[model samples]
Target: MGSCEVYPQTIQHSPNGRFVVVCGDGEYIIYTAMALRNKSYGSAQEFVWAHDSSQYAIREGNSVVKIFKNFKEKKTFKPGFGADCIFGGFLLGVRSNSGLAFYGWETSDLIRRVEILPKHIFWSDSGELVCIATEESFFVLRFLMERVTTAQESREMLTEDGIEDAFEVLGEVQEVVKTGLWVGDCFIYTSSVNRLNYYVGGEIITIAHLDRTMYLLGYIPKDDRLYLGDKELNIISYSLLLSVLEYETAVMRKDFNTADRVLPTIPLEQRTRPLSVMLFKNNCLISVLLNYLTRLSILLQFSGEQIV
Candidate 1:
């Protein structure tokens, strides 16, 4: 096989057989289970790759850590100003800004400690000891290691001006009233002054007028579905873009005009209130927390027999 060339601004690999490389400009590569199963490329902006590559992690400014047989990106163990190191099946991490934060592969949540250790660090698949540096020399240890083989995939082409056509809308959005528009698995969710609308397949179907009572808080898309969470702890789940209007009317016909109040929710007491939505386990809906917040959050899973 021809050796693949990757211009990763930052690169990392784990001994367990997984790879995570991020372009300095803002692109990421992940070796996922499905990518390995089909022997294809797995690099979607969304964290929907299949589990089995041995390590689960992503690199933004900070890394989101996940470990499981199945690829569910929700088990982000440590967030915020800290470092991590893993070796011999033992995962370790340190926290900061106030509190003890430590964890491993066994526990779903992280534990905090009183003292900090400088030597306990995680190793990468290349047998290289890697640690995040704050200034020029002081290294904070964080990040477990895994190994993964990569198959080159087509990437977005950028123009000479260092811009992509996809991001052009951002300029237009800023011209407006700072409105937000997002694409979901099955529909599009948008927010403007006092109004929330849902569109499926390019057609407007559902409309909610907040009337200055409440503001739109967040939305999450997953597996051809979208979950909307508002400021009032109301979580409304919608599937199939064409079905959004019908679903909302049926669920809130009695109080559609008034602000949402009686909706069920995934617990968010331990973490900061979510201002945005992200895809969780099995394409389920969940709120996105700040990268460094100490909160109680878990990947919401679907229990249907059809789920893989």
Candidate 2:
């Protein structure tokens, strides 16, 4: 807010990098980042930015989260009880001491209610999936948004009782996730044990091992590379093809039709990349996965180049 004298509890930058929000002391002020000029100010306890950055939300003293679209108040409603943290975006999400609840942005209907307290939540790039990270494990769920009208709200199909069937559990891992995000249908993460792995179709595979702890910055789809940074100010990258993972997932799901369509799309050199060590050691899943991969004539050996 133009370098105001008041100290803020936290500063939030919009996803599009156009606006900045300063929040503290039960209020927030918006500013145009480039001009360093104040745009608007409002009362709030907590603030969140929507996915597209076209709208924003704030938790008010009314115990409700308010959505502001184009600087005009559009929606406001209280989430499930005990929800203390706002994680709003394309969907309205709030986290409490015991669980997390989500609501539809347009109808304010309960979309999901889960009993797991998460340390981090990741929405897929296209908003088709979401990954919830807990202290002991992480799980992925597909996000479903169905358009409904008030006339259909009371129907048995569109009850406010929450859409449990829509948010399907894609996969889950017992390992603690340090950092990660989604790339296509696969979720790649750095585990607490310093192992980089990808989870798809209920299978977990270790693709690389980190000699030292590092953080995953992001993946560059154009370059087909994954970038990681360390506390020592060093940046490293690795070749991670998006199409290859997609093909693997399709095969795991037994969707040969999708696999056939995706296989030819991968580049020639990237097509033969080595398969990683799958997590079959933990349980009886090894024999099944091993026999499955063996059927793939393309995968004979496994070895990947490590970047230091």
Candidate 3:
């Protein structure tokens, strides 16, 4: 048709650029490589594109989980309780009012379910343990190895151990705004501790940005870089290079922690500035700089070749 109608939720091009996925408040629409359209699900609280881009998952507020492959229904999971879900590889982590649960793809079976105060959940690459977050708390849960042998099995696992109060309750957990979570070789989330914090995880590391005006946008695990944009139109990148203990102590969780700098720059000095930034590859940064006042967009490319 005529340039495919723009969506209100959010539209994202797959990393490979073969497909485009749109997320409405409670729905997701998938457009194929050739621009074929498919209606996936409805009443979803959130949506995540699979790493391979072959399928995507929807987290329904009613605790009904669904996944579609090639625009066909692959599987459906119902937690039996209202829960929020996050995905990694073939694993799905679901957060509920009572606790958290994990499930495997293909087979709609439970991996592990913990009955405790639930918050946010993150599964490492290995998928052995998961990090859970609450108001101002964080905890880890280890999966029983013997249970999750494969998807063909029953797919039930036990929780080994977890923390009740993971970190020191600093800032107002209610006032703390959660943008999103980044997972890979490192983890960076837009969360406010005392102010706004950029958490870098890997080899036990975490970094917090004290500036209230700054917000974390994205993270590239391969390069260990985090992209931050401020209301002042300053786009900066922070590369992870130190350990978490180097800034905070094991006994006390301090928000006044600072890691070493990587590289900081503004993508758009003119116009109203870039509303978004994407890391394509080394030296080549893709930015969608906007001038709302004039209602224009300029795709800016920042590279070393042009600097000289």
**CA lDDT scores, all candidates in order:** 0.32, 0.74, 0.48
Instruction: Tell me, by TM-score, which candidate is best.
Output: 2
* Candidate order, TM-score descending: 2, 3, 1
Query: For residues 1-308, could you state the per-residue lDDT of candidate 2 as single tens digits?
Result: 24753479988788788998889988899889898788888889888887888788888863688888888899878765755777755677778776888776656667767888887787776888788888999988886555233324555554444555657787778989998878877888999999998887677767789999989988998888999999998999988888888877666666666766675566656544333332233242443345434534344343342211
| Reference-based TM-score of each model | 0.26, 0.74, 0.54
Candidate ranking under lDDT, highest first, comes to 2, 3, 1
Error of 2 at 164 (Å): 2.8
Please, what are the lDDT tens digits per residue for candidate 1 over residues 58-174? 322333444443344445554554433322223344434443344444443332233333322323223222322221121212222221111111233322221122111100111
Range of the 10 consecutive residues with the lowest summed lDDT in candidate 3:
271-280
Candidate RMSDs in order: 22.2, 6.2, 14.2
Cα lDDT of model 3 by residue, 142-241, tens digit: 4444435542243222233222222222222232335544353233456555243433221222355455656667666556566778778888887543
Q: After superposition, how far is residue 106 of candidate 3 from its true place, in Å?
A: 1.7
Higher TM-score: candidate 2 or 3? Answer: 2
Q: Candidate 3: where are CA atoms >4 Å away?
A: 1-7, 10-18, 32-45, 59-63, 83-90, 116-119, 125-129, 141-147, 150-186, 194-208, 220-224, 231-233, 242-308
> Which portions of model 2 miss their true places by more than 4 Å?
1-13, 20-37, 146-154, 157-161, 231-233, 253-258, 264-308
> How displaced is residue 121 in candidate 2, in Å?
1.5
- Candidate 1 residues lying further than 4 Å off, grouped into runs, are 1-6, 17-23, 31-53, 59-70, 77-89, 92-100, 112-308
